[model samples]
Target: MLKTRTGILLLAPAIVLMVALLVLPVGYLIRFSFYLGQTGVQTSGGFTFANYVRLFGDGFYLAILWKTLWVSFVVTVVSAITGYPLAHFMWKAAKRWRAPFTILVLSPLLVSIVISSYGWIVILGNNGVVNQLLQFLGLTTAPVKLMYTNFAIVVGLVHIVTPFMVLSILAALEKIDPLLNEAAATLGANRFRTLWHIILPLALPGIGAGTTIVFCLAISAYVTPAVMGGSGPNFITTLIYHQFVTLFNWPFGATVAAVLLAVALTVVFLYVRVLSRLGAAAPAAR
Candidate 1:
């Protein structure tokens, strides 16, 4: 009873913060999502399902949702692919050398997100560094149109999220017993085989966690997509902003946010389920 009481006390501040900051705002948004109102400004009316009906029933909103999901998925996959090798290298490095590499991996986070987004624009813009290099290399007569596209958005998001994936996987890797690798090697398991059969299985938790964070951050991100993708109603986040800030349609904006939250939750749930199954099967496969 004492231990339980202590734990509750320890958690009190976080619980209160969550209730005050997260739960209350989300609850209000959900309640507002059902209101019937005009699109031009703030509105109040009796509860109605019109917002949801319009969201699902309209093709434009559906397309935006699909695009958001697609971009987020791409960013998550790219981040995982790029992060794993960096993480594995960091894990294998000498302890003395680890700090520099860790700092390098985390360097992106030191910069502001908006600044990072603009930096991408500098590199990817038509008259930017990339185009200048390409032209100097005689690759093309004219500059490539790289900015304000899905490609630019993916690039920016990947840069921002890869650090999280690397750190997560690295944490899991650090928890692993080093002797396990030696045991596998002594048993004549090659590096590739060891990684596939041992390291990957044990590191599954971190990979799942990293991917989840990347996906959620990518989908809900507004600034990167807004700057890199040109803010043309191409993303749900931007759409939500437009409805609430520009059009003053609070009800519609709230509905959009609610839908996004639902979709993110559903994807995370399914991903966790799949990961759990893989974890269960890992021991048998070994």
Candidate 2:
């Protein structure tokens, strides 16, 4: 009984912090969403569903939601495709190769998004490095129009999220028993067959986790989309920013944030369901 009390006492600070940082803000946002903002004063929780009703009526908001979903989905798919190969290489890398390879995977995370966005601006801009290289290689006479495009946004987001995906996948892949593959080989399984049957199945949890992380990260992104996506690839976050900062629509932004949270939670729920199904199937496969 004393030990339980002691543990609770020790955890009290963390619990307080969580409530202060997360709970309070979320509660306030939800509470505020049920009101109207007039002259910086929020009032009138009318006990009505007007805010949510308004959310569905707007076509632009719906477009932004669709775009956000599409962008996150594409980013997650691309990250998984690239991350799996890199993780496979990492698993098979020699001891000397491991350190350098790990550094390469992690190096992008060290650079700030601001710096990388600027770098992308230069690279994708007209008369920038990409155009210069293309021209020098006799590919084109004029600079390509690349900046302020959805493609640019995707490129920037992929670069940012790849390191996280690699780390997660690598951790998952590493835990897979090497002996499992060796045993498969002993049973006349080829390299590809062993990887398909043994390695990929074991790595599904990491894949699920990495996909969820990258999708959520990409969907909620503001900086890269602001810079690279510009007017072309507006997302839920950008719409929220515009509402709160530009339109002074705090209540609207709160509603949008609630929607964003719902979307993220939905994706997480689906991923969890799929992961659970995979977990159930794992034992039968073995």
Candidate 3:
């Protein structure tokens, strides 16, 4: 117990930082959600579930809420599908090749989101590169509208969140012992069988980690959806932004934000539980 106390004391700074930066702000936000913020002033603690009630009661809000979840699901699934091959490719490469490949995967995260959004606008817009190329190839008579659609939003969000997926899977892949694969081959397991049975099981932990990150990001993402969806196919985040900024309803916006946060946290919690179970059994997996 004394050693535990000492360890806690040693890590007190980090604990304090978490409380000060995260717990405090979250507490404030939760409290703010219950109050009316119409006049730039909190009216009351007034602990009413009016915000929650309204969120559930409104049809438009419900539609966008469902849309947000669907979009996030698509983005996460797409990222996992794409990132698996990339992570596997990197892991199979020689040690010298790993660094360069990792750097490449992480490079996109270096650019600002606003700038990336603009770049996508150029490539995905009606007169953009994709449409231009299609036209040039006689695939289309004119530039087909692509920007400010759900597809464009999905593209941008996937681009932003893919690095996280790759990196997460990379961590798990690096830890896998190559000798296991070799031994499987020694026993006559073909390449596909070895991979599907052995390598895949070992890599499941990383896949879970990647999925958690991807799902969380996709669910709560604000900027990309706002820029790409515009007024076309609205999402929960964009709707929340409009409510807060245009209608001056912070309490309701906070409510929506809190609900979204709850949904994200719930998903992550379930994800971690399943991942932890699978990861714990990894040693016994052969």
Best model number under lDDT? 1
Question: Clashing residue pairs, candidate 1?
Answer: none
Q: Could you report the Cα RMSD, in angstroms, for every candidate shown?
A: 2.4, 2.1, 2.6
**Cand. 1 Cα-lDDT:** 0.90
TM-score for each model: 0.90, 0.92, 0.90
Which runs in model 1 stand beyond 4 Å of their true positions? 1-14, 39-44, 271-286
Candidate 3, backbone clash total: 0
Tens-digit lDDT track for model 2 on 137-161?
A: 9999988888887788788999999
Candidate 1, residues 213-246, lDDT tens digits: the string is: 8999888999988899985778999999988888
TM-score quality measure for candidate 3: 0.90
Candidate 3's displacement at residue 192, Å, is: 1.6
lDDT, residue 22, model 2: 99
User: Where in model 2 is the C-alpha error above 4 Å?
Assistant: 231-233
Superposition TM-score, candidate 2 onto the true structure: 0.92
- The global C-alpha lDDT for each of the candidates, from Candidate 1 onward, is 0.90, 0.86, 0.86
Please identify model 3 stretches exceeding 4 Å from their true place: 1-14, 279-286
Per-candidate clashes, comma-separated: 0, 0, 0
